[model samples]
Target: MIDPQQATPRPDAPAVEDPATMPFPLISDISAARWLLVFIIAAAIYFFHGFLVPVLAATIIAFASWPLSRSVQRALGIDRTATAALFVLVIVLFLVVPVTMALLYAFRELQQWIYWVFEVNANGAATPLWMVDLPQIGDWIDEQWMRHIGRPGAIADLVQLTSGNTIASIYRSVLAAGNVAFHLALNLLFMLIALFVFYRDGDKIAGQIDIIGARILPRRWERLSRVVPLTISATVTGMTLIAMGEGVILGIAYWIAGVPSPVTLGVITGIMALIPGGAPLCFTLVSIYLVASGSPLAGVLLFLWGAIELFIVDKTIRPVLVGGPVKMPFLPTFFGLVGGVKTMGIVGLFVGPVLMALLVAIWREWLREIRTHPQTP
Candidate 1:
């Protein structure tokens, strides 16, 4: 017999508490907690919306280059930070430097062209020899040039036609251009910083992601994870190979056609080839220049050659290389490229295809599951 106050408690007995005196539960309901989590995630994404593109681009780049990074890390016998720095350095030297140089050269050329335009248009200037020598269309071109560009006050009239006659309009255009340049620079800086972070902490980050993914998607996470990186790598590799091939082939053609600065033009074409329709624009402009410079036959041949080559590459090589991993068809790949560019600009180039590939993969998986477990009528 024991007093109630001194009774011995069992170690496994659950403790009872007074409801009135208990502290309030922070997450009393699982459903409410889930909603709270969702709200937090949405808020975070909204806050970082501007940086999303650069971060996404960096992620794609890191995924595509991870294999090389690992090898580089091993060979150099260095830590992740040092290896990542080396990669960043290499990228700056090879990619950034060349692009910057090309841009500067283009800017200089543009300045000279603008100067010439204003100077010559100050008083009507004669049609150039090139325009006057453009074969069957030469006379028509000359007539038009004399009527529009070869007369005093032509520049003003053209400016008015372009809605650039007013000082305010021109000032606005300049401001817009400057704004674009500033945004581009800002984006680049952010991308570099994000890239460095991704490279440095990639392993730890991957492991954490894997743990979370496994918990969330226990069945499909493995396949999904494998598919994403492979898809990105294949798409990037295919783009790079195609761009280089187009550049080399077109560069050789340019030399044969006696196009000035063939090497430089080829490099430019290669860069342009990364964007949809950019390569075509390059060759088309070159062909027009050739015709204007009295090389009509060469221009015609080059244009035809480019068309044929481009067709072959697009219809055959692109689908095979870019879609091989995910078994994506040509139409899907084409749509992916176009849609990606339309939706997300340059970064979409990789992301669009990856998404398409994932969609195809999931579709196939569903088909397989259906086959394995037939529905009863």
Candidate 2:
């Protein structure tokens, strides 16, 4: 019933628009705009979660290997793109190929071990002498073995009593292994793809990073840049070399101690040494195997040797390599190593320490700025 003129005559009143169709209405408020931008970015990241690990891996590889790429570029008088492609090819051929081969070997060994277990279960492995020689638990171990595995149908009975579905459990474990292998292959594929891209565009990306970094942290940009590359190189090179050394040393010990699959165990130990506490675990398990097999003195000596080696490396070699004055604080280093592993697995070891180093560097620089700034009059 309202007149059209009267309804349209309110010129003195402020104009209002429908919220749904108003283009970028939130952009009018800077805080809201910033939050929206952040939301958009977060949403994008969440959407691409599948690629995140590969992205992280590629970035780490790119940053860590940039110097080599540049050197090759300069030496060969080739373009950056060519150099990057070459670097990627080299990485795949040299690094990934070797790792893949090692994995295959490890997998074959695992299959053999599993088959051995099955064979032993079917044919009843003889109880080791150590089980009868223990001071307190020897009798218990012997009894348990005799009750569960020494008899013909004992294992099946024990497994039935413990869990009604042995086949199902084994099936699930096999499926899990398959899933892990598939995911690993997928991630590696993404990593190589991303790595090639990063290597090619790394200079442009670095420039952009420099710009953003300088804008946000003008005073610390130069130092941060220098520190980051050094930290990456040091952490990667140091950790890798030390792990190799530990592996070689431990492998020799394993051989001398007559451990089965000494070479395989050594490779596993070296890889494990990349993670904190991993090396200790590797050697501990081996020692336990020795102890369970009745070589108590050998077990004790091997455990002691491994413990001492780990201690020496951690105290002396690790500190010198990863903890220079300009490098990371211990707490950050620890967190980085732990959190990286938790979140990203093996490659995280290198990524974690370098990221921690960057964070520590930023923190230190910030504190320095605060301390050196002029006081108000």
Candidate 3:
């Protein structure tokens, strides 16, 4: 106490404990309990698969439209809610309305065609001369048509059989349509609900996702999350734009060639564009009809138009729609569309390519990271 500045030194301060060396809490028990809860919920969802499907579809639609919604908000200087509403409205107008109108038009055209064929059979003479000039089996088809029309009783019997089948098919189709309408209504409702929630609480949801990703896969979380949405958006936007452009061109060509029921043929062409080998099937049928109906020039022109539009327009316009920065291999993208449609119906057409692209990107990035930093054994 005589000289405080020269007092004896105290014992060294106790060494601070390193967190790396400290024992962690027994989280295994908590983790197991949490897993059990998750398993129970999964089981419930599996049991109620019907309820889950619409919810899943809603989620997918929200994801697909997220980019557009954001763009709308930025471009229009609007709030998220307004942007989402406008986005949904536009989607309904462009996608749902067009498809519904097309279906109605198709049904009307089908009925009219059936009636026209019956009238032609009842009053007209033998087969037209142009039937013999069609490409593959034109001669055989003409011969059969002449033979069948020569016998009015045979034609009547054939018409009766066809009419009966058509009626039955229409009945079945109507039932299916009723079911589809119900499901579509449910899906639309859920989708709107999901869209609202996503727009309102997207940040919170993203944060939660990031947290979960960090907990489960701390190293690759950011990369995985970004790549998934990027791949999906890029692949979907690219393929859809290409298909739509092709459809419009083919439709215009058909209209210009004076094809009977241009709208109906255009709708068919759009559907055909979604298929592999592009619009060849529709063009071939249109050409045959044109030639048989005494417009060989129109037929040739339509065929050429289809070929040129598919090859030229697709190559030229697709890159513009889907910005070239998103580079995915074309072959995989093509197969993804075809195989996805074959396996999972129409929706798969978009999903398959996105999934394949995401997987490829993830693996590539993972390999690069590993090559850059070798792990210690």
| Every model's TM-score | 0.68, 0.69, 0.68
Model 3 spans > 4 angstroms off: 1-31, 51-61, 64-68, 74-77, 111-129, 142-171, 325-377
True lDDT of residue 166, candidate 1: 54
Residue 349 lDDT in candidate 1: 59
Q: Which structure among the candidates has the greatest TM-score?
A: 2
| Pairs in steric clash, model 2 | none
**Model-by-model lDDT, in order?**
0.77, 0.77, 0.69
Question: Please, what are the lDDT tens digits per residue for candidate 1 over residues 1-377?
Answer: 88999989999999999999999987669879889999999999999898987787788778888999999899889999998898878777876666556555555555565666667667889988997876798799899988888998786677778774753465457446667657757877898899899999999999999999999999778977886787667766666557767987897898899997677788778756765677899999999999878899999999998999999988888778666423457666667667876876655655666567656666776688689888999
Q: Candidate 3 residues 180-260, lDDT tens each?
A: 666656756765677677766676887998998989999889778887776666655665546655666777788899987
* Residue pairs with clashing backbones, model 3: none
Q: What are the per-residue Cα lDDT tens digits for candidate 2 across 191-298?
A: 998998888888888899999899888977887788777666666666665776788799889988889878789888986776566689999999988987878899
Error of 2 at 241 (Å): 5.0
Clash count, one per candidate: 0, 0, 0
